[model samples]
Target: MTNPSSRSTVLSTSLTVFAPAKINLVLRILDRRPDGYHNLWSLMQIVQLEDELSISLSDKHSSITLQCDDSSLKTDPSNLVYRAAAAVLEHSGRVIGLDLVLAKRIPMGAGLGGGSSDAAATIIGLNQLLNLGWSREKMARVGQALGSDVPFFLFAPSAIVEGRGEKVAPVRIKGSRWVVLVNPGFPVETKWAYQQLSISRTGVRPLSDVHITLGKASALSWESVLQAAENDFEASVFKAHPTLHRVKQKLLAEGAEAALLSGSGATVFGVFRDETAARQAQSSFQTEPHLKVYAVSTTSDF
Candidate 1:
């Protein structure tokens, strides 16, 4: 299936971009950096769950306005989407007016990378809308300053992201699989997760070279990926939120090939090869009204 992350539609002066959510199949938190940021090695995959952004040129020069269907989201300069628009304008040195409407579906602070994806979408939409002629490399550089996960969206649907998320290497997967995401209807602040991890660990160790060697391969099979799948934050995060641990156990009980916590998350995802099984697992969560569940497929075209 064509990944929405790489697709956008244009009509007249308006453009619509789809910002697909991402899950970290494998996340290894490396040593804490002197800059107060943690080094990371993660295999990130883009899923079908997405947010939509509609962008149109305005008559007023150097002005930008944003609107969102989700009332909880801010539409001001503090919002990632709005900041992205301003970044694009500043980067291209163009005096253009913009109107942006964001339709959010991805859960916030669920470790789904919704906000970062939206920011990447804005950069991409404006690149085409204004004909900036910037390459993905240029766009990613602009994205990196916005958020650590922002650059990954520019290289979707799958990539090995490292080093505070500035490094991105697209990788080919042998096949696609269905994923069921279960969110406990709460947010896990990424910063808080990091602090917890720091306090929990006596000392930080650098990741072995073997993983880096495996990541450099031209392609990888699902079986191999699953074998290496792990998230370093799970131990610390789950300790704080016991419900998340139960969610993972439930997903495994539902016959998921593998169940894992995605990023520093309140969201846990199950990997399944069978679509029917994935859908069934999704339905099983209906009894729990407090949990949000979605059965989505991984993008085929990396």
Candidate 2:
């Protein structure tokens, strides 16, 4: 896995970056903050599933323009990618224009962290393209303002993200495994999922002892990850969307080591020991009309 932040390439007129999707191995919602955002503790892992971003520099024009293969995605400033590019330009105070084309592969609003990944990729791409010479920590500080998950991508392939996603600590998993992601062709809005969770819980829930123990370790074995795997959103999310729960059960039945909803997902993933078992699990969802399945390896590479 190549770390983009450590690249020593000279200035380039164009750059292409791959923004990988992420799954939450363990997501625990903590207290609600005064800012109306919830503090969370999550062990996020990057998967092979990714979106592509191609960026070109234009000195003649002083505007940032974006185009996307997915028409449903906005290409304007409202888009995270565009906002991220704008942020970089603003921070550097450079009078240059940017043209970006995003090739979308990850499902939107599926708890895959596609948009946030793209935003982080943009910052990374621009940093390289313009030769800003910024460190990963500096980029993460800028990314934190865009979205909570954006900072995680800057510190990826795996990390424990805390607070409103500002604090990040990288951790290495001892071994690699295959991930089977199953998205049910529908979106679960993050806001709605948070609301559902709030309504379900009477008050702020405290973090578990297992999570505390997991957090203290710098390196984690697969066995410990499987034992500690859990998502607080599953209870309310599954109640509203029972099919997602069924998808998880099917993954386990097909020989998954651990299976759970990624974020506030309509997408559920199963961790498998090998690609063969992951592919077999993916095949089982083939006949389902509304399900999208992919068998991918877990990656620490950016």
Candidate 3:
């Protein structure tokens, strides 16, 4: 039998988790399956920027609290964090009510996987407290049920994700490229972006998932990579919101080695080879009243 002393220690413990951000270098949508999910392949990378979540046990009962710089989001059960906590607790058969606190730093709905990352972090923390001892694969299976991007956080390290985003493999795309993330103070829904896509001469609808095509892509020069940087959904997305297109152009105009839409974005990023160029581009955006800019770097992993 377990000692009461050990049990008390477990119940009073707390944990804080850091959930990072993600950027999709390429987003390609393949054929839609009868299951209602569009097949996708993406080259995803993590960034230094992140959201912090602080979780603890509720003395009174299961509880949750969330505070953020933005007051717009409801910090309650409707939030993904709530759903995630509920799932983990229920799965563990633990009656212990939790006090889950999420501090949102990553921008919401900018295609940065902010919410999904939070969900993933919650699962991990709960697994530790609840002694779930789940393998990365098992955790990913649970996370995939929450969001397509959640699985990445489970196995975290840059990955090449395919097949509705569940299949992941470690990829070696070299360089710690500097990044400038620009959020235009506008939110773009991934669903909305996909809905706007239509088959066009350039394959605007992206009938196939992304292909790395060139394997071990570490040697290519930045300029050449820019020319090859492909986002099949970009054509449709940019067409609807011309400002987004302009944002991509501006990143280049400011001297980014490569500029592309990050996921289905209202936020775009510029990749630079050096900090000097990255900082210069950030300063250049000081006059843009409509956009929020952040300096970031490519993570060694997704």
Candidate 4:
């Protein structure tokens, strides 16, 4: 499938962008490539939980400033949002400055693609604010330089991601569902997860079963989608952090249709039959002082 279009409407100088968190329904690590990056295949979906970005043109001729509610995040050039703004300015040759305010809700390093989604929002927001009118393909190409997952958000809501995360194919699920996300109040180091995975697996697997299934069907049913859900890092990650295993079990026990780690995660998400069930499941974790839980549903592309 071709890349989808970026949905941005030209507004006033200020624009508020929604940057949603993503969950991987299925993740498979193929092999470590010569470049030192692992090849992967994943089915990613966006959840209603999101970060809000407010972007506006700065009156100062050549200054860009970013502010976030989370002081732990740097608002400088080192931050992905700042870098994304720079990329658009450099790419479009616009001499404008920007003032960005990020209201973050997505947890960091939980395999939720929060940073990548924020970056994509910057590119998309700037494109509309600056009137660049770049297509989603162009924006995604620019996003790739920022990070592997950045490009996926350009075609977000749901897509098939593969090949070190540069390849994305938009897909459709039969219906919407609710999700309950449980963050363990700490970040999982992605680098460590990859290192552990590299040692655990012997070699690259052949074509993924998900890919083969998609080749025959135009779209996937909810039941079929659940049946195909799997994660390659679960074995190694759960071995390292048994607590995550208990979290999954708790979710299942609390009425989740299915539960799994999002991405080498400290966040475990449970798919539910409905929003009420999802919220009910989320409440079960409220007593845990260290856990941050949310009841959210699947969202479509903005």
TM-score for each predicted model, relative to the true structure? 0.96, 0.96, 0.86, 0.94
Better of 2 and 3 by TM-score: 2
lDDT of each: 0.89, 0.89, 0.73, 0.85
Better of 1 and 4 by TM-score: 1
- Model 4 C-alpha lDDT per residue in residues 145-186, reported as the tens digit of each score: 999999889887788898888998888777889999999888
Question: Per-residue lDDT for 1-302 in model 3, tens only?
Answer: 01000011234378877788888776777777799877887777777778877778776865555555558877777788888888787777777767766667888888888888888888887787767887777777878888898887766546667888898665555557888998888888888777776454334354332145532453333344445566767877788789888888988998887778888887788888878899999999898877888888764643
Clashes of each: 0, 0, 5, 0
Off by over 4 Å in 2: 1-11
Query: Candidate 2's residue-wise lDDT over 1-302, tens digit each?
Result: 23632122224688888888999999999988899998999999998898988889987798999999999998988999999999999999998888899999999999999999999999998888888999888999889999999998888888888999998988888888999999999999999999999889998768888889889999899889888999999999999999999999999999999999999998999999999999899999889977889999985554
- Candidate 1: residue 194 lDDT (0-100): 91
Stretches of model 1 off by over 4 angstroms after superposition:
1-4, 208-210
Off by over 4 Å in 3: 1-12, 63-69, 199-228
Task: Find the 10 residues in a row with the least total lDDT in model 2.
Answer: 1-10
How many backbone clashes are present in model 1? 0
- Superior by lDDT: candidate 2 or candidate 3: 2
